[model samples]
Target chain A: MADQYTIHFGILGCANIARKVSRAIKLAPNCTLSAIGSRSIEKASKFAKENEYPDSIKVYGSYDAVLDDPDVDAVYIPLPTSLHVKWAVLAAEKKKHVLLEKPVALNLKDLDIILEACENNGVQYMDATMWMHHPRTTQMRGFLSDAHRFGQLKAVHSVFSYLGGDDFLKNDIRVQPDLDALGALGDVGWYCIRAILWANDYEMPKAVTAWREPEYNEAGVILSCGASLRFEDGKQASFYCSFLSNLTMDISALGTRGNLRVHDFVIPFQENLGPFYVTANSGWVGMSIGCDPPPTEHLIKTDLPQEALMVMEFSKLVKNIKVNGVAPERKWTSISRKTQVVVDAVIASIGKGFVPIEIN
Target chain B: MADQYTIHFGILGCANIARKVSRAIKLAPNCTLSAIGSRSIEKASKFAKENEYPDSIKVYGSYDAVLDDPDVDAVYIPLPTSLHVKWAVLAAEKKKHVLLEKPVALNLKDLDIILEACENNGVQYMDATMWMHHPRTTQMRGFLSDAHRFGQLKAVHSVFSYLGGDDFLKNDIRVQPDLDALGALGDVGWYCIRAILWANDYEMPKAVTAWREPEYNEAGVILSCGASLRFEDGKQASFYCSFLSNLTMDISALGTRGNLRVHDFVIPFQENLGPFYVTANSGWVGMSIGCDPPPTEHLIKTDLPQEALMVMEFSKLVKNIKVNGVAPERKWTSISRKTQVVVDAVIASIGKGFVPIEIN
Candidate 1:
C-alpha cells in the first residue's frame, strides 16, 4: 500500500511551518510536494526553485490557484489562523483533502461551516493537531486503558507557554489580531485542551469556565488563559496557556493510583534539551535519564521546508484517500467534534466573564 | 504579656488531632492543659493520665462540664464534625473561647448558631485551620502582593488526598449518613478552598461547580470530590479532595508573570521532610524552600496571638465582656463573615453537584 500511492501536496502558504511540511512531504515515502502557493509571487517562485522541483510543480500567487491545481491531491493550509476555515472550505469545495492548522477556526460557527463543506464535497478535513498522532500519546493511552491500574481518571492539568521575539512576532500570524483567531488559547492552548480530551478518549466536557487577561495586543487575543472543564463522567481538566512568557509545556493526568505527567508534549526531543521527561506520582519512580531516545533520533529531523506535523499527517490522509478511494474511516470525527465543543465553550466562557458554559 | 498570662486550655473530644493539640499545649510555655472531655469518661481520664497531667487537671465525660469549668479559658472542640456546632455553641454559652474543627458545622445554619452563641456569651470562636497561621503562607502572600512580579492572578489548583483505613471509615464523623455533608470536600477540601480564598485576599467566588463520588459504605458520604470556583475578579481555583487514595497534597497559584506553588500546606515542616518547597514560574526563578514553624510559634516565638488569629476572636464582642479590663473590638466579625460566605458557597456547590452557585 505504501508503494502503490503517494499524497501529492499543494502548499497554501510560504510560512515556516508550511515550509517544514513541504520538506516533510518530500521526505515522506508516500508523499510529494506537488506545488507551492503564496500571497507573494516571488516567495512562491523562490520556494519552488530552492526545493529543486520540476517545472510541472506549479507555483501560484494565490491559495485558490494551488487548490485548483489538478496534480495536487491535497492542500496544507498554514495561513494565518483566521484564514484556516476559509482555506479549508475552499480546499474542500475544490475536492482537495485539507490539513487545517490547529484550532481549526476562531469559533464553533466557522468550524461548523468547514465541516459542512468537507462533508458536502466528500473530501477529508482534519485539524492538524500533530501531537495526537505521536507515539508517546498513543503509548499514554495504552497505559491508561487499564482502569484498575490507573484508577478513576480524576483531573488533567496542562500548560503550554513560550516567549516570542520581535522577529518571530513581526510576520507571525499569532500576534496579528486580524489574522490570528485567538491568541494563546487558539495557538497553544488548543493543544492542551485537545490533548486532555484525546487522552480521555474524546470525552466531551459537561461545562467549562475560563478566565483570560487583557495583556494581549488585541482584546480578543488572550495573553494568558486558564480553563476548568468538567466532564459528564465526573472527570475534570484544568488547562493553562500563555504567550506572554518563554516555553514551558507540561501535561499531567491524575488518577486514584497515581499521576502521569509529560513535559514538552509538542516537541519533546529538541536539540540540546534531549527527550521529554515523564514524572509519575511526584517522581517517586522514574525511568531515569537517557533512557528515551534523543529528539534527533526520534523526531523528524530535517531542514526541509514544510508545514507542521499535522500538515504532514493530512498529506498522509490524502495519500490514503487517493489509494483507498475514500477518506480514512472517520476515527477522528469524534475528536474534532469534541475539540470544537471545547473551543466554543472557552470562547463563550471568556466572553461571559468566566461564566460556566455548558458544552453541547 | 507572656510572663503575666497563663494560657488555660479545655479540650472537647480526645480525638487524634485533639491529642496533637494537647501535646502542643504541653510544649507551649505559657499554656496549661486544665481539662479534657469526651463522651466516654474512661477515655477522658485515661487521656489525662497518659499525658501525666496533675490532679488539678479535670476530666469530664460531658462536653458541657469542660466548658463550664471556670479554670478553662479556651475550649478546643474536635468533636464529631456533626457535633461541632452543638459543642462550640455550648462552650461559647459558658463564656469559654472556642476553637472548633473545620467545616465549622454541617451547614451554614449551624455555623450561624455557633456564631450567635459566641456573640451573646462574649466569647471567641475560631475554626482551627493552622495552614493560614503558617509563616510560609504569610511569605507567599507577601510575594503575591507584588502584582507585576507575579503577574495578574489567574488561577489556583489544589489537591489533598489520602487513603482511608477501616478505622477512619468506621468512626470518622465524615462518613456518617445523617450528617449530610460531602466527605472529602468537608474533611480536607476546606483547607484547599481556604488556601485559595486566602491567597486571593478573601475574594468571594462568583460561581462554583463541584462533583462528588458516592461513598464506599454510606451512600451519603463522598469518596472523592472536585470543585471549580470562579471569583468576581475573574480568577479561578480548581480543587480536589479524596479519601479513596493515597496522600497527594499540592497548592499552586498562577499569575501573569509567575506562579506560587506549595507542595504541602499542612505540616509543611516535619522531622524528615525539612520544609515545604515553593516554586515560582516553573522553578526558573524566585524559588524558596523553608520550614514553617508550628502555629504555637505565633504565641511563644512571635507576638501574642492577635485576636484575629484566635479561633474564638468574636467571643470578646459580647455584652459586658472585658479583656484586660477593656472591651474587645468587633474587627474579627468581618473576617468570620467572609470565611462563612466561602464555606456556604462550598456546601452549596457540593450539594448541587458542583453547579455554578452565584455568590450574593
Candidate 2:
C-alpha cells in the first residue's frame, strides 16, 4: 500500500464531540492528534494525558496558539455554533485545512468570511456533516431519483428532535442567549434542513414560513421550530426540530409513483439494531433494529464508529489536498447558504407571528 | 328486529362511483333503489332493468322528475361537481335526504344553501366522505389519542393523489373547470385536509399559504394546487392534490411520545393493501394486508361495501332524525366553514403568486 499520507491534527475545543473526533484521529490510518487547545491550559493538558497522546503532542492554552503551531497540518473545530467561522478563518489564515462541525457558522455572512479566507489561503474546508457521508443516504438519494420506481418527487417531511441536557442551558457558547439566538435551528435543526435541501437536489426554496418558540432565558433565541418550504418546481418540504423533546428522527419523501422513508436519518451505527434498508416498489422492506447482525437483505451497515468513519473520510480529503492541492466540493457552500436562509426565516417568522416569509 | 326501516333510494348520476353506491344500496339491510335518473331516459331504463329493481321502480326522464316523485325518500347526488348544491337543495325542498358526493359544494355559500334547505325540510344531509367510516381510520384515531402511545399532538403531514382516467377527464365533474375549479383540494386532497382537522378535534388552522398550477379552460378554473396550513398551537399540516398523478396516499402524525403513519389513508380495500403500519419506537410491527381471518391488532375491518357502509350509516341517522333531531356530530357546518377558508386562501395564493393568506 502506497505509504499512507500522514496528516497532523489540531483540535480547537476539548468538548465531548472534540474528544470523540480526537479518538477518531488517533484511529485514522494517516492522521494523529498533534495539538490540543482550550481556554484553560489545565483542561487541555488533562485531555492529552487522559487520551495518552505522546508527550510530543502540544497542548495550547488558547485556540490561536494551536493555529500557529507549525507542526499541525489541519484543525478540527467542534466549537460553538457562533465561533465556527472565527476559528476556521484563523486556522485557514495560518494555512491549515479545516473540518468544521455542522452549521459552519451562525449566519451566512460568517460562513462567507470563512469560505473567502479558505480560498485565499488555498486550503480544504469541510463541514463535518457525517450523515451525508453514510452509504445509506446515497442509496436513499438513488431510490428517490429513480424514475422507474420512485417517480417524480412531490414533497418531503423530516423531523429531528431530542431532549437536550441541562448543560445546554449553561453559559456554554452554543446555548448562549446572544451568540446563538436560534438554538435548535443553529444546532440540530441544521441537519434536518440540510437533508431536505439535499434531497431536493439543492433547489432553492421559492418561499418559506415558520413557527418558532424561543427559549426561556432568551426571548430572541428559538428553542424549537417548524418550517414549510416551497420550491420553484412547486415541490414542498415541511420540517420540525426541537431541543425539548425526546430524540425522534425520521424522513419520508412522497413521489409521483411511490414514497421513501428513513426511520433514523442520522447515527445509523451506534444502533444495536439491524441494517437500515430502503425499498422502492415495496415500501420499507424491513430494517433491522438494535445491535442485531446485518440481515440478508441489508444493503449497507455502518459497523464502524461514526466519529471514526468521519475522521477516516477527513483524512482522505487531507491526503487529496496534499497530493492534488484540490479544494473540497463547493456543495458545502450551497448547503450553508440554504441553512442560513432557513434560520433567518425561522427567526423572522417568529417575529412576524408565523407569517409566510418569501425567500428572495 | 322492529322492522328494519327500508329506505327507498333514487340515484341521480350513473358514474362508476354511482354504480358502486347503487349496488351497495341494494345490499344495505334497510335500503333499496327505487328509481334511476339520467339525462337519457333510455340509459336510465336500461340501468334499472339490469339492476332488477321492481317494474314499479321509475326511470326518470330528467333529474327534476326524480325529485318530483314522492316515493323517493332520499336522493344520492353524484352529479357533476357544479350541480351538487342545486340538486341537493331541490331534493331537500321536496322532502328528501341527501348523500352528496365527497365535496358538499363548490364553495361555502353553496354548502350553506344546501344545509339551510335540509334544516328547513327536516331531512338528513351528509357529505359522503367514505374514508371517515373506515374501521381502520377509527383505529388510527384511537392510537393517536391513546395517552400511553402518542401523548400531546404536535404535527401532521398528509398527501393524496391519483392519476386521472380518460372517463374521469371526459365526464367527471372534477374536470369541468368551474364546478371543480379547486382541482386537487376538492378531490382527494380534501380527504387529507379533513383528516388532519378531524385528528386534531376540529382545531381550525390559524393561517394558510398555498400554490397552484394555473391551467384554465374556457370557464377559467384551476386544475391542481397545494397548501400549507398553520394551526394555533404551532402544529402544522401540508397537503398536495393533483389530477395528473397516479394514486399515492399517506398521513403521518407526530406527537410528544410516539407517532402514527397510515400508508393508504384512503381506499385501503381497493387494491388489497392493508394500511401498512409503523411507529417511531416499535418500527414495522406487521402488515395490515389481505382480508382473511383478519388480524387481531386490526382495529377496523368492514366487510360491508364502501357505498353500502355509507348508506347503512346514513340510514341510521335518517331513522333517528325525529328522535334525535339530526345528531350534531353528523353535520359538518363548522368543519366546512374552516375548509372553505383554506380553499379561498389557496385560490387567492395561487392567483397572487403564492403570497401568504392568513385565515381569520
Candidate 3:
C-alpha cells in the first residue's frame, strides 16, 4: 500500500459550518476526518459527539496541535474571517494542504501572503465555495459556453440575501466589525461576486460602482448593499446582497439568443435535485399575445451533496500531489484571489461615496 | 337600457397589434367594434374580414371617416408613435374618447397636447398599458403593499427584452429614427419604467441615470439601454430594455421584510394563468446549507385576457362619463403623464452621455 491510503483532514475551529463539512468529509470516498481543534478541547469533542462522529478521530485544544500533527495531511479552516490569514499561512507552511473558508482573507494582499506560503511549501489550496463543485454548475457552464444556445452574454444579475433576525443581527460573528469587517459584502456578497465572475468566465469587470445608501450596523459594518459591474466588452452585471431582506439566491443571465434563471442558486430547494430554467432563440408568436414556448426546466440530480463533492475534489487534488508527485493546482488559488480582489474593490467603492472604482 | 348601451370603438390603422385589441373590444361586455379605418380601403376591409368584425361595423379608407362618424363613441389609435399626437388629439377634439397605444407620444410635449385636447373636450383618455388592468397585478400589488408580508419598498429591477433578429434590426419600425425614435427604450422600456413606478405606489423617482454606452442602431436609435433610478427615500430601481436580447419580461421587487418575483410580468406565459413566485420572511437553517421556507408560487387565473380587461375598464369609464353624466377619471391621465415624464428623463439622461438627470 501507499504511504497513506486515505487523505486525512484536520479541521481548525469548531465553527457552525464545520459541522456540515465534517459530515461531508466522512461522506467523501477518499477523505477522512482525522482530527479537529478548537480553543477549548471540550467544545471540539462535544461537536464531534453531537454530530455523531466516530470515536476514531482525535480532538485537540489548540489549532496549532492539529497543524502540528504529522498524521494530518490537510486542514480545513472555518475560522472567522479575521483569523484566516494567520492560520491558513501556518497550515500551508506546515505542509498540510488547506481548504480555507471564504472571504478568504478579507483582502487580496493578506490572501496573497497565504498563497505565497502554499506555493513555497507546495500545498494544495482551495476555498470552501462548495457550490462551485456541484454538477449542476457544470451543466449551467455548458449552456453558457455554447454559442448557439446562449450566444454572446449581454448581462448577468445575481442576488444573495437572507433575513437576519434580531438575535443574529446583534450577536453573529458575521456582523462583528473586527471578525468580519466586510459584513454582508463578505458573507453572502462573496457568492454574488463569484457567480458574476463565473458567468463572465473569470474575466474581471473593468469597474464597479457600489449602490447608494447601504444600511449599516452601529459598528459601521454593512448590513445591505448592491453594486453594478461594468465589463469592457459592453456586457453588464449587477448584484444585491443583504442581511436585511428575505432569503433569495438567484442568478439571471441574459445572452443575445438565450436567457437562464436559477431561483434557488446557492442552495437548492431539494437535497438531491437542482433545477434551472433556460430558454433559447425565443421568438414571439400569436402577435405577442403570448410567448410561443415557456422556459424549459433542466433538473440536475446529484448522489452526493455539493459539500461532499467539494471535499472529494479537494481530496483528489491533494491525492494527486501526495501520490503522483504532481505540483499543486494554482487554478483554485487564482480564482479565489481574483474573487477577493473584486470584493475589495466593492468595499473601496462604497467608502469613496459610492463612486466607480477601477479594478486592478 | 341606457342611451348608448355599449361604448362603440373606432380603431384607426390596421397595425398587427390592432388585431389583438380588436378581439379585446369584441370580448369586453360594455364595448363593441363600430368602425375600422386604414390608409387604404382594401387594407381596412381585409382587416375587418380577417378579424371577423360584425357586418354592421363600418370600414373606412381614411382615419377622418372614423372620427367623423357620430355613432363611434370612442377611438382606439394604434398608429406609429411619431403620429400619436396628431391622431389622438384629433380624436379627442371630435368628442370621441381616446384609448392610445403606449409610448404615448414622442415626448411629454406631444402627450400633453393630446391630454389638453381630451380635457378641453370633456372626453376620457387612457393609455393602453394592458397589464395594468390584469387581476393578477392587483393581487401582486396587495402582497407588495402588505407590511407583514412585503414591507417598505427598497429596490426594484425590471427587464423587458427580445431578440429582434436580422430583419428587425435591419427594417423594423422600432429601429427607425423618426418612427419609434426612442427605439427599445420607448417601446419596451415604457413597460419597465411603469412597473417600477407601480411598485413604488406611483411615486416619482428623484433622479435617473442611463447605463453606460447603450447599443444603438445605425440611425442612432437605441437597440438596448439600462438605467438607475434614485428615489428620495434612498430606494433604488433599475431597468434594462433591449431589442437585442432574448424574450424576457421580469419584475423583481425587494422590500425590507420580503421580496417578490414575476418572471413574465408584461405578458404572462399562459394567457389564463399568471404565476408569480414570492418568498416572505425566509429564515435559514443548517448553517446556510438550506433555507427553511421555499418561495410559494401563486397562480392567478383570469377568465378574460389582460387586453380584454383593459378594454372593459376603459369602456366602463367612458360609459360613466357619457351615459351617467359623470366627470372623466383624472387618475388614469395623471399616471400616464407621470410615466411619460420618467420616459423622457431616461432619454434625456442617455442624450447627456449617461449623466444623472433630475426628474421634474
Candidate 4:
C-alpha cells in the first residue's frame, strides 16, 4: 500500500516552468509525482525518462487520461494563461486538487469559475506563485508587522523585467495576442502586482491608474507597462513589468520608521539563502552628507526550496480533505482571486485610457 | 593684487546645508570662501568660527553686503526656495555667478527670472545638485550611452525618502509655507526628478501626472508625493519622495538590453567610492528558477567629494568667463531650467486634481 500521508500530483503540460514545479513536487516530502500528460505519448515518455521519474509513474498522450486516473490525487496545470480556466476547472470537476500557474486566468471572471469549480468539488486550489512560500517572505512580513521596526506602510514599488531576445520577440506565445493574451502584463506583471498586494497584506487599493500608453507589439499585446495604486489610508504602490528590459526584479517597501528592499525578489540568486536589505530608525549623518547606519542585510535559509515548500503546503491542504475529511481550504483560493482581481483592474485601467480604476 | 585664479565665494545664508557647501568651497582647488553673510553679524561670525573659515574671510550682517563685495566672484545660495529668485537674480545683477540650491525657485516663472538675470549678466549659473558631478555618475552615464551595453532606455524609477523627526516636522523651514513651501516635493523630490531627467539624457517627458492626492500638512504643504512621466518616445519615468518614510534613496533605470540600479543615488553611502549595480544581456536560468550572471557591482572612486567636485566645476566655469573671456555656459542653466519645468508640471498636476499636465 502507498504511504497514507503522500499526495500524488499529476502534471498537465510540458511547459518549461512545469519542469521546475515537477522537481519541486519530487522534492516535497509529502508529495509524489504520479503522472505526466502531453499531447504526444513519445514526448511525455521522453520527458519522464529524461527527468528520471520512478518506474511506477505513468505517462499519458492526452491530459484527459491523467484527469481520469483515480490514483492521481492532484493536478498541476502549467499551460498558457488562456487555458487555465478550462484545464483547472476540468481537473477540479474530476475530483483532483488544482495547482494552477500564475496569471491564474486571463482575468478574474475565469479565475472565479475555476475557483468555484474547485470549491464545489471540495478540492484544494492554489496558483503556482512559489515566492509566497519562501521563508524570507515570512521574515519580511515579520519585520513589516513590527511596529517599532517598520511602523505603518507608506509605499510599495516593484519591478520585473527581462530582455526578450529577437526570437522571443518574434515567436514567443507571450507576444501573441491569442495565446498569452495578457502578454507581459499577465506574464511578468502578475508577480509585481502580487508583490504590491502582499506588501499591503492583500488590502485592495482604493484605485489604480495605469501609466499611460504602454509599449505594445504589432499584435497589440503589451510588452511593457506600469501602474500606480493608491490605498485608502494614503498608502501608495507602483510597479513596472517589461519584456524589453534586462532581468531586474525588485521590491521596495517603505514604512513610517523603516524600509525594506529586495533586488531578486521573484527568484533568488541562491536558492538556499535569500537576502534582503532593511533600515530602521535611520537618520542623516552630520551635515546631511550621508545616512547614519547604512541598510543591513538579512539572510533567510530554507531546508526545502521555496517551490518545494509550495508543493508541501498544497499537499497538506489536499491531505486534510482526503484523510481527515475536512472541507477544502479557502485561503489559497482567496489569495489567488485577489491577485487576479488586480490583474483585471490593471487591464481595465489600461483599456479605459489609463484612467483610475476602482478595485471593487 | 589678487591671484584672480580661484573663484571667491560669498555664502548668502548660514543654513545647515550651507556648512557642507562651505566645506566644499574650502576643499575645491579653484574656489575659496571670501565672505559670509547672515541677518545677524553675530550669527555669521559664529558660523564662520564653527565652520573654521580662514582668517582672511569676511563676515557681514546683511546678504546685500555679500552681493556688494567686489572681491566675491560667486554666490552660493542655500536659502529657502522662496528666496532663490530674489537672491539669485540680485547676485547675477551684481555680476556674481550663482550656484543656487535645487527647486531653484517656487515655480518656472521665478526660475526664468533667475536664469534671465544670469544670462543677461554673463555670470555662470549652476545649481548645487552635487551628485551630477560624481565620478560614478560619469561612469553610469558611460554605460547608459553605450548602445551595445544599454541599448534604448525604456523606464526610470526614483525614490528619495527620509523620516523627518518630530522636531523637523514641527519647526523645520521646509514645513513652513512661507519658507521652503514645496516641502518634501521640493526638498527631496527635486533630486528624484533630476535623476529621472539625467537617466533619460535630459529629454523632458511629454506629460506628467501626479499620483493621486499627496499627504499634506495642516499648513497645506506637501509632505509626500509621487508622479508618473511619459516621454514622447514611449519611455516612462516615475518618482516618489517623502519626509515620512525611512531614509531610503534609490534609482532603478531600465533599458532594452540592460539595467542599472543605485541604492544610494542621491547620496553615496561612502564618500570616496560609489557603487552601482548593472546587468547587460542577462538571461534566465534553466526553468526560470533564477537569472544567470546576475547584476555586478561597479565601484568608482573620486579623489574629491562629489560636492567639492561641484564647487570646482562651477568655479572653473566662473574662471573661464572672468579670466578667459568666454561666455557663460548655457548647459548648466538649461539643465536647471528643465528641472524646474518638470517641478512646475508636477505641482500643476497636483493642483489640477491630479490630471495629466502636458510638458511643452
- Which candidate number maximizes DockQ? 4
lDDT of 3: 0.89
Task: Summarize candidate 4's per-residue lDDT along A1-360 as a digit string, tens digits.
Answer: 349789999999888788899999988999899999998999999889888888899999999999999999999998888888888889999999999988788888888899899989999999899999999999999999989989999999999998887788767978887778898988899999999999999898999899897988888889999999999878999999999888888999999999999988888877787889898988777787777677889999988889999999999999999999989888888888888888888899889988899977
Q: Rank the candidates by DockQ, best first.
A: 4, 3, 2, 1
Best-fitting candidate, measured by TM-score?
4
Identify the superior model by TM-score, candidate 1 or candidate 4.
4
Calculate the i-RMS of every candidate, to one decimal place: 13.6, 14.3, 1.7, 1.3
Residue by residue across B184-239, what tens digits does model 1's lDDT show? 76777777777777777877777766644323455557766677677754566777
Per prediction, the TM-score for chain B is: 0.82, 0.86, 0.98, 0.98
Model 4's i-RMS, to one decimal, reads 1.3
Give the CAPRI rating of model 3.
Answer: medium
TM-score for all models, in order of appearance: 0.73, 0.83, 0.96, 0.98
lDDT tens digits, residues A30-64, model 3?
88999999999899889888988888888999999
| Model 3 CA deviation exceeding 4 Å by range | A1-3, B1-3
* Clash number for candidate 4: 0
C-alpha positional error of residue A330 in candidate 2 after TM-score superposition, expressed in Å:
3.1
Across A1-360, the per-residue lDDT of candidate 1 in tens digits comes to: 224476778888887666555655665566777888888789999878876767977889988789888878877787887887778888988888877777678777788888888878877877767666555666667556656545667677787765555554444678667887587788888888887886677877788877534345534556667777877656767787776553446666766655555555665433112122222232211111011111111233333212234455666666666766665536565577678788788888778876789866
Instruction: Give the 10-residue window scoring lowest on summed lDDT in candidate 4 chain B.
Output: B285-294
